[model samples]
Target: MAQSNPRKSGYSFAPSPSSLGAGLSVPVGRRSVLGGAVGLSAMAALTACGGGGGGSDVKEGTGAISFGSNQSDAVPKAAYKKMIDTFKKDSGSKVSINTVDHNTYQEQINSYLQGEPDDVFSWFAGYRMRFFADQGLAGDVSSVWDNIGDDFSEAFKASATATDGKQYFVPVSYYPWAVFYRKSVFADKGYDIPTTLDEYISLSKEMQKDGLTPIGLGDKDGWPAMGTFDILNMRINGYDFHTSLLAGEESWESDEVKDVFDTWAKQMPYHQKGGLGRDWQEMAQGLLQKKTGMAVFGMSISQQFQGAEGGEALEDLDFFKFPKINDEHGTDSIDAPTDGFMMSAKTENGGTAKDLLEFLGSAEAEQINTEADKSIVGPATNVDTSNYTALQKKAVELVGEAKHTAQFLDRDTRPDFASTVMIPSLQAFIKDPKDINNILKDIEAQKKAIFTA
Candidate 1:
């Protein structure tokens, strides 16, 4: 099983070995990857990226470049190795590769970027990308965009661009966050897909009557629950509200945000109890065993189904865009985060970094990467969709239909707020649903301090 979480494994980008489905693609709007983690100066002493602990340079050949990768799962790791091998073959450059565990890499990114980041390194597209660009840690890739601009959708270009409007990230793949369910479970139960909040709630009640948990949630790692919160906030409050809220422009103590929690608390009876004790993989197991009806996550959820029975487990898995809560947003928005790569601003091999980024942004690189791993969709507009499975096609359609695309909560907000404040806050909310107002006030206080700093 692929075990990457944007918060857990840095997100699994390979299809579950069990499912025969082709690559998963979710075309989110204004596509970008990343969380706004620490806003430290990008010019800090080059310790992590240049140090032995980080992605240092490779002085092996006349034209050499180093790549730091976080696709740590066995399948995706192998896929990346193949990509690097192919790059070496095609470009005739001595490519040095450094691989790190996914979550570890993200956790250490600040130090990594400030230390000895590779010439090119794997990263996400949005606030995370922008945060780095704004800090001056990421290499300016406007020139690479000059060549590949028209090849991507404007949304993707927007994803690659920083707050200052310079392109710093190069997106290679993406997937959508949706409610995943077992087709067989729904088919045997004869339950229809609900479009509205009332119908969805009613459906949850029906699932409960059928002796199935309505939703499978695990927040032991703290980040999994954010998916649930993201969908609900977007559904109830709308996308713009969500973007502003994450940007720290809106008050966390508002009645609007509280309504999202109150409604969620009402549905708590149907949610898996003991969520704080379970991680997402355990929740996925509940769906696989028919103990639960559905889960809230990205296409990467399929990654949980691996091994000999992967095909059977995956064949039964299907997802729907999260149900609508309000007529205004009305299911027109989704969390479809884009994941890709960036470059160190001070890479000794500057020209080499740009060349590699150009290739990484190419349909050829997208093809190579997607073919090696089936967990995500190739981001290049021209990548071959001939091999797309029914589910992959559905994911693309779901995202393409969306009017607004939110990077997952962690990706959308400041890293400090997300990892430090929100993760524990949500986990605490799951543990004790009664302290809603206090939680909001505390979060707002922290947001004020962090944003001001």
Candidate 2:
């Protein structure tokens, strides 16, 4: 990590040890948006009962800050575990990590916050964090940022700030969304990364001729499709319209949205079939296995290559920004979601929570995270890139060079609309790309109700 750790943010807490070191997945919906207590309830029970390891020695101000986590997949889980271990060792505070399935956390976040929740929890920036802060659910972290303020860029600081102009989140890491492919696959096929819409389409058709699935698409569990829509909309209509659309300021039934749907519909034939039955993990697997030429996704897809395969296959992984579809946009925008920690408004251990946020914002914590899982780049301005895999280096550059960074679609908009309306709607489009007209109309109707509500 490159970010410099500055002042201590004037928070104090003692350490307590946690037992649940590894993260686990319960597998919620087909595609999940992300956060929660419902998913963590079972895990919490286990943590309370010491099911993950032995027993926890809970303390107050110096006590264990219950950490609500949603890093369900193994790679991030392991990375988080190491990072948490470092925190415990450094701060001498115990963290009882209640790990939950990724999708379940997001689906039940409101209830989780309203219910008794962990003192500190995983969360994203944008409307997601702002919404909770607006509802008085998230604790203010303005003071925490006062000490670590220089560690992050202004853009990241803005993302972590709530609508009320207070910092509610401490960003740690983020990954850019792009067209990921195994370099070996491209090298073997003598394929060059596409730079434009025509080049991309031509490459897809060429891959088909070579008996390779051109694009890997998995809509199961649902939100993976949102990545597709986000990139396409930005590429076609530009970022402002896309962001406005997500905010429900623009009609979903407009020609701009229709054009994105139309483009995706035409490209559907080139996408892997049976998308509704596969998750993003499975789609990443296709790229790893060389069955598919490329997958439009975040670098986190490399999580699938960890453990058994090591970084060799991942070393073969590379990406190109989704090619420019409109000269107006010119690959200027990216859905590079900012992920970080937030404190619950109800946390009785505010001191300990802020202390933990202090450690989390440090370059040391980011170093642990990035080294363990190279898929993510530490957002800390001074992060060390010496140990970075080639892909990580490229990712840092890719994100830094972006003109506009978006918190993925779900994060940028209403959670209800994203999960309830858009998820199903996009899944339907994947099932029948022909009826996009009706699908968008239905979405606009739902958008009206949800945004108004």
Candidate 3:
């Protein structure tokens, strides 16, 4: 069910009760402040299985390392734990991890700049890491990066590098976003995955005619909608325009972005009913149950879908990349989110952090990632992905050969812009499409505030 509007922002800012469970509701008056708390709880639960011994001496060469992890799903958590355990056995040094809530993990890390600090922790690439580097909380890893092979992929490195040309983090995993659909519905309707915008719209219309919601959407968490919007915008305007907007080089009101909003307005009706208040997991349930014909979501949705309904329900479920928008950005692009690790500048165990970072890049770590199914795209460039599902393998191929792949919006832009500009603008577009100019203006103002303040 939809959560009640917090009555503070005059918007339904709380996550849907069904999404995270009944007890986790968005805070009323202090939405921003309390959002972190939800994240904190989630992170703590994820990292609970991993523990480390107390800090020890450098042992002539080795050093003690402290680590923190953002709330991750069971798979990634298990993979990380295995990696840490192996590190302890190999290096003979202490490695401690302090787990926090996923929602508030970033905030908690930011607040921990005082006395004690984790040596390394998971982080998103792009502006999120840039914020920490700017604040001097992140350590410079240029020297460490110099040792990794060029085969690790330049795109991955660039994602973790700041505009000032400093490497601050190393990405361990990434996965693409696409439309997951019920194959039986498509087979019955004689509809194949649409390759053009017109075909996509026409297909959606036909699905609606057959009494099926063509798209499953959940805006209760906000980020899911933003993810769809980002993909649509990227397809419409291409990577250059998307990058310009993210780098603050282009205004939000540009014709390119306007087209994205216009497309969303035209496609809104095909979305699942009550999507505005549904959470991502709930929306995924709709797809799994076949109540909705399709859902545009992350690769992670596969795990939840299979878990909920078993593999039989997924026998007729499949995924396809968002259809091409005139092939302007190249028809083969994929959207992915990269999660990585960054070392603290104040960490007492720089050597240990470096060891872990290097270890993460090894084939052994990649094997752990694959065994745990933590990511569809593992960090080791040399690993064979023949074991991955057909769709997963396809996504990996697309990402590998693509001319460009941008990180998702929330990670690509500064947090201030993500909160004050991108998310709000997308939400405004949903509430009132005619307010495009106002939304753009508001986002621009927020961008200015970020730079000035």
Candidate 4:
């Protein structure tokens, strides 16, 4: 049985593993295999191609443009406010930002989608965007894309583009997710960050033996667990196979995917025993307090901890890329979800919004994001790394050098499939480790139904 939270948490369900059922199985022969340098070069070229416009089209206007975001921190709020101020000054438009509670932001977005649509808003890439785009709530940004050229990273732009090749959103910032642990704890245990599957398990076992929970998991939010599962899946099947599986072209029952879940089941015991019931914030607190040795989470969690407790405790915390699964496929990388901005189809100020989007891609907005601490990996635009901690800089370097970094499963796939198939499948797996095959079978069946329907 899944553990119950004593905290009376509002987010009770085990986070469904995938946000949208975007994962599909593709034939191995059709997968695109671009090296990291090639990928970056392509993105750079894309941006350069789009860089010729000036800011003359935007000036003060009478239109009041409302923006929305789920960012909860003062840092992000202040930085965003500064950007809004700049937008107002340059465009002569009255910009209003509605900051909502992070937990209820999605619901707010859903509600707003039904009522008065704002001019621009923040959204997750992949699955979430698909739902809005498909529903006609999001505007096609192909014109904006041509203007913003190579200013947007190819991967980031691809994230906002649908399979039909139309772009709907513009990315603001993105960061990599990984296992963050205390450097002192590793030193005390004489364990280095693992680079292979065997070493990973062995390290967890040693940590467990020393009376330390190896992972500070909080499935109460479900997303953190989903993040872990995504990383594991990416490593097991490789990015190409994982993408195909999410796109409905492949089966989850494949040996590679099964191995991924089986490996996760083996490590279940190393997680904090009651992790199934804890919220991510609480789990982060536990890790910061040193009650657990590690937490498989996004860089945002690190920023949250540092903000809540000050930087003193965070000095010992460092992160490592998810370990390589096998010697043959040795890319030390993990899921990277890019938070982006999009224009509403209903917005009256399309020109103003377009100007803001281009401004966001500039070095000025990138600096704002860095100083806001909203981005651990910072923006894709060129920025000085001297202000970031060594660990943060290291994460940026790893992502830049990655052979391929996928968006998280929930972010990459479709929402209905994510909520119905992916998340539930993971919950069922947690309920019964021996039921791994059944879980995959169920997911496979769901994928077929959704894609064929």
Best by TM-score: 1
Per-residue lDDT tens digits for candidate 2, residues 1-453, read 111010000121011011111112332331232335566555443323211111112222556678888776666677778888888888888888888865566555655665577888988877677767776768888888999999887768888888778898998888889999988888888999899999999999999999999999977777778889999999999888987898889999899999999999989999999999987677878888889999998777766765536658868888999999999889988888877898877666788888998889889889988776566789887889899988889988888778778888777876567767888899999999999999999999988887774
lDDT of 1 by residue, 1-453 (tens): 352344335333211111111112321221132324334333233242232211223222236878998888787777778877877888887888898877667767765775667789998877778766775678788888999988887667877888777898898878888999989889999998888878878999999999999999887777778889999999999989998999889999999999999988888888998998887788888988899998887777776764427478877788987888888779988887887889887677767787788888988877776765566777777777778765666777787788777778878877767767887789888988889999999999988887775
Candidate 4 deviant stretches above 4 angstroms: 1-64, 71-75, 98-105, 108-116, 134-137, 143-152, 307-310, 327-329, 346-348, 448-452
Error of 2 at 280 (Å): 3.5
Top candidate when judged by lDDT against the true structure: 2
Model 4 lDDT vs. the true structure? 0.67
> Sorted by TM-score, highest first, which candidate order results?
1, 3, 2, 4
| Candidate 3 or 2, higher TM-score | 3
Error of 3 at 441 (Å): 2.9
Candidate 2: minimum summed lDDT over ten consecutive residues — where?
1-10
List model 3 lDDT by residue over 1-453, tens digit each: 110111011123422110111111222222134445777655433433321222222222257777787534454566678888897888777887666545555544444432245788777776667766665557777666787656467767777787668888887767778888877777888888887888889988988888878899877656778778878877888777787788677877678777888888888888876766787777878877767888887766665555445566645557887888846575545567776788777666678788887777666666666666623566557766767666567666666765666777766665556655566667777777788788878887777666443
TM-score of 3: 0.80
Q: Could you tell me every candidate's TM-score relative to the true structure?
A: 0.84, 0.78, 0.80, 0.77
Number of the candidate with higher lDDT, 1 or 2: 2
